[model samples]
Target chain A: MENSAIIQINQLIKRFPMGKGEFTALKGINLDFGTGEFAGLIGPSGSGKTTLLNIIGSLDMPTEGEAVVLGKPISKLSSKESAKLRKESLGFIFQSYNLLQVHTVFENVEFPLLLLDYTTAERKKMVMDALEWVGLTDKVKSKPPQLSGGECQRVAIARAMVKKPSLVLADEPTANLDAANSHNILQTMLNLNRELKTTFIFATHDEKVIGYLKRKIFLKDGLVDHEEWINQ
Target chain B: MKIAFKLAFRNLIGAGLRTWLNVIVLSFSFVVIIWMKGILVGWDHQAKNDMEQWEIGKGQFWHNQYDPYDGFTITDSHAPIPNEFKPEIEKGEMVPMLFAQGTIYPQGRMQPAMIKGIPANQTLLKIPTHKLDSVTDVIPAIIGEVMARSSHLEKGSRVVLRWRDSKGTFDAAEIEIVDIFSTTVPTIDVAQVWINLETMQEKLLLPEQATLFSFANAEENRPAVGDFRLKTKKELTAEIDAMIKTKSKGQSVFYFILLLLAMLAIFDTQILSIFRRQKEIGTYVALGYTRQQVVTLFTVEGAMHAVLAAALAAVYGIPFFIWQSKVGFTIPMDTSEFGMAIAPTMYPIYSVGLILSTTLIVLLTTSVVSYWPARRIAKMNPTEALRGKIQ
Candidate 1:
């Protein structure tokens, strides 16, 4: 109920229908995320960490109780409404970078902005500004395939932040990168969070990802086993 | 929508091989369908045009009764075409007299032939009088030069016509040869002869009747006939040329079926091309394109290929049509049995409507056929689709 808490979850549950019965992914879970926090949702594979992130991301619905972001009940939003909300209020960074490989980095960054009816000049300016923030301003004309794994991840970050979304969900954003590239990406994301006051939510199993987050939630068998917050 | 198109365009470029393959398959299918439609419709038009040009004005009549008892009875009989029926042959309406028979003898040689009685100046059906290259002004009682030469008939030489009379008796008439002509259309030149209708009708005592009548009237409504069935110029040819048309249509129908099968084969390839690009479609969806947008993208691609293929077909088709027009297309048809010109030229007459509609149909069929599969690709969930599990 705190003013800083931008995301609220109350007894949220998610279950997948297997052969006959149900397989629960997220057992009754309660969590709250404040504004401008670098949080990690960490667990081993199939630990329901990704499912929990997806439910919060409004990409999937919770089976029981409420999952709210920006005070909007995400599970109840219509597909279009959810899409609009995701476009307006959230940015996504996927493990594979998910940059449209056919497009240039600038075009990719300008993609989310195109969904809104922004002026051409405004879209250009915002894209360039976000690309600069990721230190990829010179690589705007480069395609994803032309860039290194680290640079592609940076382009993904630039695309996510170009719209200035309230929350950014990065699902294994550094999974495809090398150890040095992973550190660089994590550092870039942390720096952007500090400079832009953008909240970062990460779903990852990497130790490097956990090491960088101020707050960590470890999910085991769909239950939140550990929760910690560090401010420094 | 623009973003979707842009994305689709970009994706098409990225997937070059798959896109072109689909285009080629679709274009090939379209060309086959269009080509079949063109040939059939063209042949029909050519036949109709030739019939009209021969001044077969338009309609034909047949006797319904068993036999004529007397002139008075003939003037008032219960025939399908009553004897009292006298159709007005106006300026535009050309009522050329036609008396047809199977056998005509020249000296020692006996040959089966089709003799058409027409006006001296009236154009012969076999002679391509409309040709810009023709040197003669009026076609003079057109006949096969081969027959004329073999018979050693000079100009103005008399030839005897032998045929069965109404009472089934043998009748003979002598007519002077006016002219002789050679044509690639063997159906006319090989077994056909042309003479003045008035001369032949009087020579044969043909009840002063015309077996076929053609009237060029723009009237939307035709006047009622008491007993004789009134027909348009087109309808007249239908009656006189019905047997020829029926045979031609049958052959074309067979050709059409074969061509349609070929088109379907190409269409099957297009479908396969679409199936093969399922992953590419998943990539499209993951990029946030809508279903309709995706459909339009592939549809445009299909249309592009159609245009290319249609152009290619036309390149080949036009020359083929011209070559056939000059040399003629013959199938050794026998017109002796029916008493008509047997060596009809298979001239290619292009129908604009036929070509346009057929091309459009090809495009529609290919696009519609490509839709469901393309839609399946467009509507797939990125979460599952990007997983790339073969199903």
Candidate 2:
């Protein structure tokens, strides 16, 4: 593995119990992702894109192989260790923009930092900066229910990027957005990736998301079929 | 832990009426349990205090043969008053009483009764024994209200009294009722009559003899008299203690049921919260919380309802309890009908220990019920939960 590689997978297999039989979500697959890469796992639903992303994010473990994230084996990490990795190094974005509905936009962005031991003043400054990046400074006190779909997704992005984690796993981040909103979100993520050098791995089949990725790994039936790199 | 508290507080506050509804119900339990327990404590104190004042004067010494429960023993119960108690009696700290089996005919109806002779000038008990000092051709006597009602007799009414003297000879005389005293202690009130000690000693031809002696204060380390057994205040009130214990046991079941109703509301709310907040659970997991941490968060959230309820209870319960302590609680039924020392109106007594212990019990029970349902979060699949799937 190169020094720049932040995530490395070898013969990764993920299976779930279906009735009395086992259903393979991700077949034996090998993949590597380097730092500062804007990448997406492109495939239809149930093609193991999310399964693989979950494995890399340390939310789920590989069944038959090793998934190393930030030099920690995903399959071997204890629950506490996995939580620590997620808290300190990895960020996750969901398709539905899973902002804490009862919390203000500022509180949602401050969630990840609360897991760490940041001073209150440090957290406040960092949250304001992240919200400013997403152009949501005016909506800090607004709760998710009071915001539009586009604004909610922006808050989710601010929350994921608030800690300036080395890796961010976004799953179908644009699936619930309109075309204009999707473009706006993708452009913001792209600019953050270039400026902060933060590695982003997205599990999405949305063509609009695909058009903005620096590299695309096409997955077919739980296998990597092809890979493409786009010129900036 | 700090973050858990913070988030739990936010979640509880955010839930709005659902949270307050459970809190109010639990708060009602807190107030009622404390109030009910206070009434029992007050009754216990009142009953014991009344017995001390009206009947048992701190302690007593009984002649070995005297048994208050058996009327047959009264005929042989009297002896010459002990010389050791003479000084105390002269000092007005002790009073001697004599007892004998007797019969009364009121309105041509006959009834069995006990005739007691107490010093007319004694102040050891609340009874109006001075009424017996009336000088008249007919002997003056005092009886409790219950005895008066049973004999169809009233003040100033004359009744024929017959009794066996120490020599076993029957004597009869007409006695004038001097007074009818009301008392909570049935032992002092029911089926009894009182007369002047000097007059009774002369009538029975047993001068300077008494059946029992009551003292105004407990005397510790006193030498035992040869023919009498000393009874401390605690020993004298043992029956009342036993009765209160039995009553307290019955009361426990009521508070338990009351707590169960409140706990059911909290448990129901917790179960509903877990079902409805799956996505929030998932979001917490994705935000770097372990499943156990999420369980802790939910448990804390549920437990916080009790904290809020306690505050709410104090808001109203303090004033209500204070006012109750002053105004007292009146039993709807006649207390005299209960055939016990219960007063018609009982004032509740509140102690810090009682309030704190009750609060702790309810708080612990609420937390347990809350945690019982929240444990399910630890087994949830985060991936599915994030999608808002029912697990």
Best model per lDDT: 2
Global lDDT for candidate 1? 0.65
Instruction: Please report, in order, the local distance difference test score of every candidate based on alpha carbons.
Output: 0.65, 0.90
- Name the top DockQ candidate: 2
DockQ for each candidate?
0.29, 0.72
The superposed Cα distance between candidate 2 and the true structure at residue A101, in angstroms, equals 2.5
Q: For model 1, what is the alpha-carbon lDDT of residue B102?
A: 38
Please write out the lDDT profile of model 2 over residues A1-232, one tens digit for every residue: 1138888889999999999999999888899999999999999998999989888888888889999999999999998998899999988888999888778999899999999999999999999999999999999999999999999999999999999999999999999999999999999999999899899999999999999998999999898989998877
- Which regions in candidate 2 have their CA more than 4 angstroms from the true location? A1-3, B220-223
TM-score of each: 0.76, 0.96
Q: Candidate 1: lDDT of B107?
A: 69
lDDT of 1 by residue, A99-194 (tens): 767678988898888777899999999999998888998897898889999999999899889988888988899899999999999999999888
Per-residue error (Å), model 1, residue B170: 3.5
